[model samples]
Target: MKHIVPVKWLLARLYESDVVIVDCRFQLGKPESGREAYEESHIPGAVYLDLEKDLSAPVGEHGGRHPLPDAAELTVKLGKVGISNDTRVVAYDDQGGAMASRLWWLLKYLGHENVFVMDGGFTAWKNAGCPVSAEQKVLIPARFVATVQHNLLVEVDEVRESLGTGRYVLVDSREAPRYRGEAEPIDRVAGHIPGARNLFWAEGRQADGTWKSAEEQRERFADAGLSQDDEIVVYCGSGVTATPNVLALGEAGFTRVKLYAGSWSDWISWQDNPIAVGDEEARNDG
Candidate 1:
């Protein structure tokens, strides 16, 4: 039920019954790299989940690049991966929990509270000299039901409304350059939403790629002007990377946090939506 699990704990329970380890390593540009890596070698008994194919639905014009997959369909997919209501799930990726947190958040949104993201991700496992295996695991399928939590997500309309009213603290979780519109390598527009403050998702990690402690995380959010009671909504280029910020917010004692699943990609999809460029002060008028 822990939000983050240490690599040592994961290794200790690597092959335990009712425990499922998911490998979520992925590259945004090369979608096949994650599966290829898993095929070569992964934690013993670990199953692979592709960020684009397994975790997200097909990309469309409006829902950003990595949209949430259908809940019923995702439930079936989880069942196929041997995840049930009672199974303890642990997900990890090479890039900290950037990709893995998506799976962690998805499971939590689906009402599976026993899921956790492996701290430091797969890199930590390798660094610690844990054993790896190339043999694929085919688990006995179990039934998984999606008990969706609608409150964890905010639609485009909600984001727009909140922006106008300042009712919610909107956070843009992309890098500073992307938020400042200095450079955008992805998405059509090279800017961010109006009135959004930049809180790069990478700030949640330590120099070694592990997450900071809850005390340190709280301090980080405080430095960013966030408080525990603020109605915070986080978004990024797409919905994927922002999950780590959501996890960080939760660890920092924030209760009213939600993910803007459609993010900036979906925002710019509409011709009417305004784009903000330059410094945060200038973007305030966007």
Candidate 2:
């Protein structure tokens, strides 16, 4: 029922008729490797969803590298994968929960509240000696109705408009180097959006790969000077990695948070948008 479930929790419900486990393991560099790994060996009875093909829309001039897929199309895919309105979903990945959290965020945005991300991902399952199989699963399709929750997402225009207004707290979820414009392996622009503070998504997890406790998450955000009531807007390079931070904000007791689904890539797509390099300025101003 929680947003992040442990391997033991999933192992207990592995065979439940109402539960579906999703394999969201993806590599940004090798886009096909996640499917290859799923084909090679995955959690028993788990289904695979490609980040590029299934989770996101085709990239155009505007919607960033990984745009949100159409709601109708996404729910249709969910139906084919045996996810009905009431069916519970548990998503997992090897990439430290980024890919899995993307699915978790999508399901939530589609108004599916029963979805959850598996903590520590497939590696934790393997380390725990859980069963793994190479056989692919095919389940009876069911209707999945989507009620889109538009509040969970913030477009580039909204992000731009909120700058220097203090209406929303912009949190850049990229690594410190990328946030500081020191290194950029992806995206043409190196700097981050003006008036954005950096909070690397990886900090939400512990050294052992498990997510930190609620209290720990609170401490993490509090150290970043974020309060529970702040209207936080999170973003990453192409909107994939920011989901973890969004999830982390929820765990930290923040009820109001939104994801900048276009992220930096989309932000930079508009040449007129302002970008800030180095560290954040003393004030949150565009």
Candidate 3:
């Protein structure tokens, strides 16, 4: 499944036994807020998914705040959340696709093929005037199968090689300031890959905070002179926000998009690795 399956399309499949609708709306500073809003009202039968609590492993000084969860524990989370091998999972968040996209990537990384992010997210759902409810969902335990798909992800070494010849198109999906290295919000370093292009994930959305049509998104990425079929890779602070880019790229009909799972955080951890800050910065540290 491509990254986006429209909200209306999701409404139709809400009752399918094979479908698992995960509400991934979350806030970085206010971790409890996502659950509060979810408990207040959510799509009927939708289960709340937390980025920091559910999607990530324990945090540490070296690893970014949201470290990748171990597969053994992830299987347990999936089982409790009603995600089975047959599940077609759908994820959404209020702020564009920020938190939801993380699940979209995690599901795929864990080798589940039936998952997609709700384009435009909950905002689009409300605008579309869909139904909402305050009732909590009851889940029946289900077996969640997981197998790591390493090809779906790349790392610092892979990034270095990609930069060696500019053969890989590295796309930065952070906000403008972060992408331009003008602000250091999360990571200690401030900059982007030398040959990378910025497409701020929010730009992939509409004025109403919904994703643009697939065709429009295609044109926007194309404006950056990216070839649709190239070996395109995406990244953000810690392989979290870039999931939207992977989703948008798939929606834009790109068949070979990949994510740098370790992302900038991992890149910066390598002491000998090269670093570039602003635009017009040299492509290689050497």
* Top candidate when judged by lDDT against the true structure: 2
TM-score of every candidate relative to the true structure: 0.97, 0.97, 0.91
TM-score for predicted model 2 compared with the true structure: 0.97
RMSD of each: 1.6, 1.6, 2.7
* Shift in Å, residue 75, candidate 2: 0.6
Name model 3 segments beyond 4 Å from true. Answer: 61-63, 281-286
Q: Which residue pairs collide in model 1, if any?
A: none
lDDT of each: 0.90, 0.92, 0.83
> How would you encode candidate 2's per-residue C-alpha lDDT over 159-182 as one tens digit per residue?
889888999999999999999999
10 residues in a row with least lDDT, candidate 2 = 277-286
TM-score of structure candidate 1: 0.97
